[model samples]
Target chain A: MIDNIEIIGLIAGILTTSAFVPQVYKTWKSKSAESLSLTMYLVFFVGIVLWLIYGISINSLAMIFANAVTGFLALLLIFFKLRFK
Target chain B: MIDNIEIIGLIAGILTTSAFVPQVYKTWKSKSAESLSLTMYLVFFVGIVLWLIYGISINSLAMIFANAVTGFLALLLIFFKLRFK
Candidate 1:
């Protein structure tokens, strides 16, 4: 049986990953990223990449899935940041 | 003895948790969050809280520690978002 904590983690992962979707959508439609800090997001992207590697190393389904989607979103934000700036 | 996977998790956790600090600092100094999507962060905050709870339930020290710090940073961002806007 799957553990309860993992379930909770999955739910939390979904919520957090979905959180980025709106940011991507807004940035895409609004075509603005003036308030975003480039350094902050660049660091964040690196962090996400590390999480992805760690997740893969540990064979964590939740971690891998969450980081993959979140990483994609972070990339999108980065794209918006560069394009809009 | 601490296993390698957990070590990776710890390193990944620290990197991600610290990612928010720069964002908080930038937002604080800039006194603006216009480019940030409010809905995204609102959902993200709730997600972080869930991660904290899940971490506690699982007795995962790394998750608990990481989420606690990230949650604080997220709160600060939310505060800045509200105050600056």
Candidate 2:
């Protein structure tokens, strides 16, 4: 039961991390970061980075995977923000 | 060093969770869920829920606090989405 729960957590993490793709794609395609605040995304990126480090420290693959993908998506958004705005 | 790092993680989690306030407030005040995607928020909500459960299982307060606040905010967003749209 516990293992099943963990597996669900891992799966959920993956899905959420992947869900950012559409936003990333839309932002990239439109060249618009107007709706996305730079400060917020920057801080979010940093937070996720720290979370990734924390995940590694605890040897938690789920956390690491989730944060890694999230960080990547956030970075893309940040890049678009800088590029367009 | 480790304790300090964890503290920082906890603080970051809090700030990020707190950062969602403006979005929630705006959504609530404007009564607009046009910019927000329901499916995304719904999926994100469930993901955060699982993350919270995982955090509790592993005895990680940082994750718990972060996801709890995030889930609450997401729930608010969902409520707005339903009410407005």
Candidate 3:
């Protein structure tokens, strides 16, 4: 069973991952990404992919889960940037 | 010494953490946060703070380094949001 720290990590993972939800929603609704930084998101997407690979290697549930979800969110943001452009 | 995977994790950490530099720079230059989502950044900041604590508990250099940097960037974003307002 996961201990307290891992549990803390898990909760942190959940918060960070879910943090993207509102962003995606707002961007989707607005269909305007003028203020969003494409370069930042592109670099960040690559970074999350690396983090995902790293997470898999380490087998940390929190890392894996958080990066996986964050990766998707980054992709969605990129998609919104492209579509809105 | 750190192994291959941890090194990969470290690189990922640097990339993701640095991803915000361009954003912070652009925001600082423009001094406009209209399209930026305050909710997302605020939530993300709290999450990263938890991540910092969790990383310290686990003694994971990658996590600690990443979250520490990302947390600073997130705060910068929030500060821009408020200041630009």
TM-score, first chain, each model: 0.90, 0.87, 0.92
Model 2, range B53-82, lDDT digits (tens) per residue? 888888887888898888998798788889
In candidate 2, list every pair of residues with a backbone clash: none
Q: Can you list the residue pairs that collide in candidate 3?
A: none
Better of 1 and 2 by lDDT: 1
**CAPRI rating of model 2:** acceptable
Flag the better candidate by TM-score, 1 or 2. Answer: 1
**How is the predicted docking of candidate 3 categorized under the CAPRI scheme?**
medium
Instruction: List runs of model 1 lying over 4 Å from the truth.
Output: none
lDDT of 2 at B20: 65
Superposed by TM-score, candidate 3 places the C-alpha of residue B55 at a distance from the truth, in angstroms, of 1.5
Q: TM-score winner among the candidates?
A: 3
- Show model 3 residue runs off by greater than 4 Å: none
Across A1-85, the per-residue lDDT of candidate 2 in tens digits comes to 3376568668868767866676677677777655555676677778888888888887777887888888988888778879988
lDDT of every model, 2 decimals: 0.80, 0.76, 0.89
Question: Ranking under DockQ, best-scoring first?
Answer: 3, 1, 2
lDDT at position B29, candidate 3: 90
| Model 2 chain B poorest ten-residue lDDT run | B31-40
lDDT of 3 by residue, B2-43 (tens): 888878878898988998998899899998888888999999
**Best candidate according to lDDT:** 3
Chain A of candidate 3 scores what in TM-score?
Answer: 0.92
